[model samples]
Target chain A: MPQQRVVRTIIIADQQGLHLRQAVECAQAAGRYQSQIILVSGERRAENCRSPFEILQLGAGYGAAVTIEATGPDAEQAVEEIAAILSRQTSH
Target chain B: MEIKRGVAVSPGVAIGPAWVLDTEEVRIGERFIATGTYPEEIERFDRAVQAAANEARQIQKTVSERLGEQYGAIFGAHAALIEDPNLRQEVAAQIRDHSFTAEYALSRVIRRRAKILAGLNDRILADRQSDLFDIEKRLLRQLVGQRQAQLQKLSEAAILLAHDLAPSETAQLDRQHVLAFATEAGGRTSHTAIVANALGIPAVVGLGPFLTDVSGGDLVIVDGNRGLLILDPDAETLERYRQAQAAQAGHERELIELRDLPAITRDGVRILLLGNIEFPEEAAQILERGADGVGLYRTEFLYLGRKEDPTEQEHFQAYLKVLRQLPGKPIVIRTLDIGADKFRSAVEPPAQERNPFLGVRSLRLCLHNKSLFRVQLRAILRASAFGDVRIMFPMVSTLAELREAKLLLHDVMDELNEEQVPFNPQIPVGTMIEVPSAALIADLLAKEVNFFSIGTNDLIQYVLAADRTNENVAYLYNASDPAVLRLIEQVVRAAERHGIPVNVCGEMGAEPMYAFVLIGLGLRQLSTPPSAIPELKRLIRSITVEEARRAAQAALQMESAQDITNYLRDQIRRILPEALAV
Candidate 1:
């Protein structure tokens, strides 16, 4: 069977953008799923959603559009969880 | 013996052995490893990463338990980064593919990542570049087998000497064993200085590069009062410092004896002494110092040093903390007084103001961001229900701004009323007369507010057009200047005419000489630091209002700020000869 793929685009709404703390949170959430997650912002693509450095290098500042794509058995759950973490408006 | 000068941030003297903190830079011996040794290098890298992760977790546990969960969370984040599978993979790949040494591979990967972060346009993200470097140092320490100079595990009391201290290291400082600290780099407003002040530890910063001149276990004297770091003091100098230390203690004891006494003049005029505190935890110290109440509860701390603007609930909790601590006492909650630059995360991209002091700051920033202003007002109103909470707006240079702020407060009050929130609807509103325009038109402002609080620190700076922090022009920023005195007198006269009480809630009120002038200029209330209340009360108790008024009248007639300052000093010296010793 072909691997299931899930994709969703969300705007970074956090006041401080997708900062280190938020990046850490997103990576932690992505690490839980057995799926390959990719975060695309503008022309840059973070190949490893589980890597905070890759996610941070995306430079997904406030209001920047980010597309989360996942491919695996739990692709849908991975994308949703990663999107939820990135779209949080408050730091806490 | 060598003497070095720096900026004195926290007061008091500390004499102890020096504990030199090593810089974070790690030396990597070899950059590359032989192809045959690549596998061994990878194993070493893995072990180092594990050790660094363990260290981070250990710090997190100790800091979380000692400081708070929030501070502990910083280390937890560090641990997560240290144990990052991606970071480990990159380091291992560097070692295997390039045949790089473990130390070199870790440094190369971390530095590249840090450079990426540093190059980012976002300041908040760019600031985290240091954290990456910190992690690199931690891992490198493990790989190099270098023992960390653990400040938290100091066995004996010592004066910490360092080129600079990281925020994490400063937070983990064991106050019992860390007597005081002096650094070769830092300013008055640095995080290290603020932490030292909060911990009541003597600290001097920005002493230039003198770490090489001294070694660990060298006896040192940190004269925080004079911003001097005396390394290997001579016997004569040491004896003088010992006497000074004893004198300081004796002086404090003498002031503590006057805590219960009212700030009443010899001629029977009672003066209200209050405290200016930044944190809610300081409310108890104000009461202990025998202050009447809190005159200026600076609310900016809630908005500063945080990732986001404090929620309305957070603001309410902070105000409620102070209120619960000082029941029935008047607490003046000054609204947000920070510049727009500070809220760059919440607001638009920073425009890099050439002069932030004159830019959209304080009340102006609040007016531009009404939602932010309303959140604070709502919180203040909510907390007003608990105690005698009076709202004060800072940097109101114009009548329109004051009217607009008051209008917003009314709107917030109405909203609270609709929501059936119990609050003091009749809560007093006041304006900080710091701007020269506010002082010039004090009568107009007095009519709009329940009271007036003369903030002489900014008033002197504005009137003289001098930056107090700039050493070159700091002399011009004198409270004893006739221009400043005239403004205070005008504001006082205006408040008197309008039948409103005036309070001086600036550093000017803390000094005996200045307090004499302020009291003579007809200010019945003075708010100063909690530590200053007893001394100010002592000064108040030593002189008569008649004498103070006469001295003030003479000082106002003087020509230069220097002349007026000398005149006031002479008057104060005669009134309280013991004040000179302090």
Candidate 2:
């Protein structure tokens, strides 16, 4: 096997849903490592933590669970980091 | 490699891969639904439509993970708009009755009723942001479609290249990856440039339509310091940027040489040199550039771009953050100087006037609305306990107005004390010497205030009756004009007679060319952006009091403003060519 990365689910339970501040925190955390971060929800998937709008395109509303996958030297770290961001309430 | 050029919005240079943040891809998804399709098609359309919206939200969440909540919020807001009852019903009705897919149904309603969705109270309707949506709604329908054009996400620590970007889209940028930005479309003071300055990102904007010449990920060199853009860099171009960067670094290294050096003249007169900052992060630069303190912390930014008024606690926390960073530095916070050209969502809707530039605004508005001023005053008074805090009011036209503002500050301070809030009771309050009436009666106004900071930007505009934005009157916006200098000289003398200190925090002060002239005019304090500190420090060190005083005395004899400008230009051109060139 070449390489494998684990994908886990994250629920956007916050009413504000996945907003920009969380995106920034998540991206910064993911950026700390050398990993390819990816987010998959339903049949659609994208680069997990990219720009704020890209994350919103997944349209994972309240009560929706999102799959987050990271692969690279620091895959596990990236997943943990993004998960933490998605867990917080919107800081408005 | 590709190359382009534009107006330099901010300064600094860094090279990296390209990360273009575009919002076009966050549009309605596609679905194939016939007008006369089977009954089952309508249900499928509804399901697809819901899924598309769901997909958009998930994408927003994922990107927010990468970028931040700002981008997440924008999409979140859009997501909410779609979920609005009227809109949801309209889209659902269109899907069922017109037999259209959900994405198609939503897009139709959005396109046809863009005005309704983008009214002053509309979900898409925002003051500064409305204009961007107006442009994007049109462009999104034409150039972009869901899943057609790919939105790029570059590795961290990369420069951004783009033809153009909306202000909100630009601001939501993760500045870490985006080192420098060069745009195809923008003006000198475009929103993109404004946000770039706020983000402290080195940006070159307003390159016109020429950005189309460059494509994706071409090796680009944005010399924002010189407003030059080089593409397909040859060895010489690369070496030039490297050398220029090294020399710039050397210049900064020399600036650090002034870290502990006092801003003193040959005559041994010492002056406080401070920096004007717009954001909290800029506090770091204030220290790095060796500013004695912050002369003018424009709190207008706190009210700008924000959807709601900043709570007193929020403002206190921000002020505390900056004050803690620069413990002993005097931070003169100019309270919410919005008006004349700025507006915030929290502000009352401005009545359409014949001439807004001369309309009732700034201090006039704040005085009229006591609650607005009180919230800010409470925040300031609360934060004062932490550091050397001072308050300066803008657009004060009379002594009574100064008294009124001071009274409001007292009320806020009393409340803070009663509420057991710790604050600096003896905090000095000042008024901007901008209104001509205030300058003419400087003696009376100075009596009511603790200090004065001449807002030369507006002072010149009001005194000369010259709108700086008007091209024809721009010629009158000269900072070195005799009329303006004379007013400043008068104000300085009045402040001296009253035993109060006066400082200049306008662009005129920031301009290194007038560093000596202002000091010679009895100004012991000059607050400018830190970028100009190195050059200003050079001018301050180079001149003797004897020379500056004589020049000021001679220049005062000139009658016309142009004569004063020409005189200062020639005088500085003769000496301190480096500062002038910079």
Candidate 3:
């Protein structure tokens, strides 16, 4: 049986917005593992935050609180990495 | 032996002795009957294949350690293929009976594998040029070790005329000696083509089959603008090309001298000829070339060079460096222009993207990534306090988007106020009228944004529904097309109604011939490359806006886009008869 992990992360910075670089980082880190990653906004569960194009497609604006859940090998690692990405609220 | 004829890619005339690069040859082993037992021959062949595999692995490691994992992976894959169990058995059978050298044996395998990867490299490279550079880097390492390779011994300032250049080899090219580049294997949209364009070096590719016949030093001339390659030209043709080159040199000297002169017309009509630049260092070069100010500073590169979002401080320093150089000149900075097509990050990347250029890029990407966009806005606004600076948004197609973007700009201002950072409160924010919706409703969008700069690159592409790279439709991608012309007119008229200044910043503005027409069409402020200033100044000093307006009206009345393009191209041909054909 695989361990499950859930992390609540609030997008703090509203000004710069969650950009392509951040989304790319999130997607790239998550894509490396075989974890089933899902970004949940209230009742909506956004599938696989590992693709920047998909993240942009979601139209997830700034200051939005989204829950991240990961399950599989390296699930805890993926959730923590994505949470850290959101905490910064910006990418270079 | 001495050779003088070759396309001038980098543009320093050199007369150097012939140095031929190693010509990759196709090898086929001749079958010879086995003198000994078959199993013994098979064993010997297996050992030879293993040796080749070991050699490949070492090369892969060296490449990976020197370059990166991405480059190393390419050779590693090739090594795997070379050592594949099936291939080893097949090639081993041929070599033992035929008694061929390792070079011949390797070529035989490569020829069969070529059919699979055949043209996929170019297709993949067209979508992402950086990927092709990865391949080119690996090939350069492989070539360096080859015994017969002749490029190692080349003397200074020579023109490199090859069949085609892999990305690694292109990266390794010594600009000091390579005057120009021409190849038989690359198209206008190929990796080599973009590199040539960026370097501003003259190059022509895709002159297929001609690569096989030319020696190392055959007098070759590359006309990049027209995609023409002349080989073995007689004395008369050489003299004509040399004269053309000389005149271009003279023209450049004239621009340098004009650097100190004010960019004014004969009637003393003061026009602002600003430089559209990328790097902050390039801004210095632009000023040195006599630009009035920095008209278009592409902010995308700040985000592009690094894997992370640039810190507000990082962005400020880069902007300040340029501002310090030109204290009085206005710097119009466009926000980050990245999307699926031009991203520089490593993770959850814009993967397996399709049509990134037309899809989520520029302003659309900005909206999706608000946090990233806000930081840039704050920095640009902060930088404005140091000198005259204006912020512009690219690919703005909607009034709603413009409204939202402005509000975001305001939000940044609020943060700066809280942080007690000093910045200009009245800094003007502008939107580019590159899309049809923005141009059509320019009056409305112009109200929200401070000004409009007509980005004809995107404007022409969208209006004509033609990708400039697409060979089938590239002929249709004309800015002079009546549809595009009408859009430009609409945007300019709308800007006038609101008293907002409108400018042009496309390749069209850079050409001296098109400068006349753009001026006549009512674009008073023009931003182009620094090198184009003197010629444009000379052109402006010669023609009145009235003559240009007359030409524009006739151009719009032409039936087909090609007709209009031809008419405009010909009109400019007469104005500056020796300008590049494009």
TM-score of each: 0.71, 0.66, 0.63
Q: What is the C-alpha RMSD of each candidate to the true structure, in Å?
A: 8.5, 15.4, 11.2
Flag the better candidate by lDDT, 2 or 3.
2
Candidate 2 lDDT by residue in tens digits, B481-551:
88888899999999999999999988888765577688878888988888878677777877787788888
lDDT of 1 at B112: 87
What local lDDT does model 2 show for residue B21? 43
Give the candidates in order of TM-score, highest first: 1, 2, 3
- The numbered model that scores best in DockQ is 1
Taken in order, the candidates have interface RMSDs of 7.8, 14.8, 13.9
Tens digits of per-residue lDDT for model 1, B435-528: 9999989999988999999888888888999998779999888888888898899999999999999999999899888998888988899999
Q: Candidate 1, B317: how far from true, in Å? A: 1.1
Question: How many clashing residue pairs, candidate 1?
Answer: 0
> What shift in Å separates residue A22 of candidate 3 from its native position after superposition?
18
Q: 2 or 3: which has the higher DockQ?
A: 3
Q: lDDT of model 2 at residue B116?
A: 35
Cα-based lDDT for every prediction: 0.84, 0.69, 0.66
Count clashing residue pairs in model 3.
30
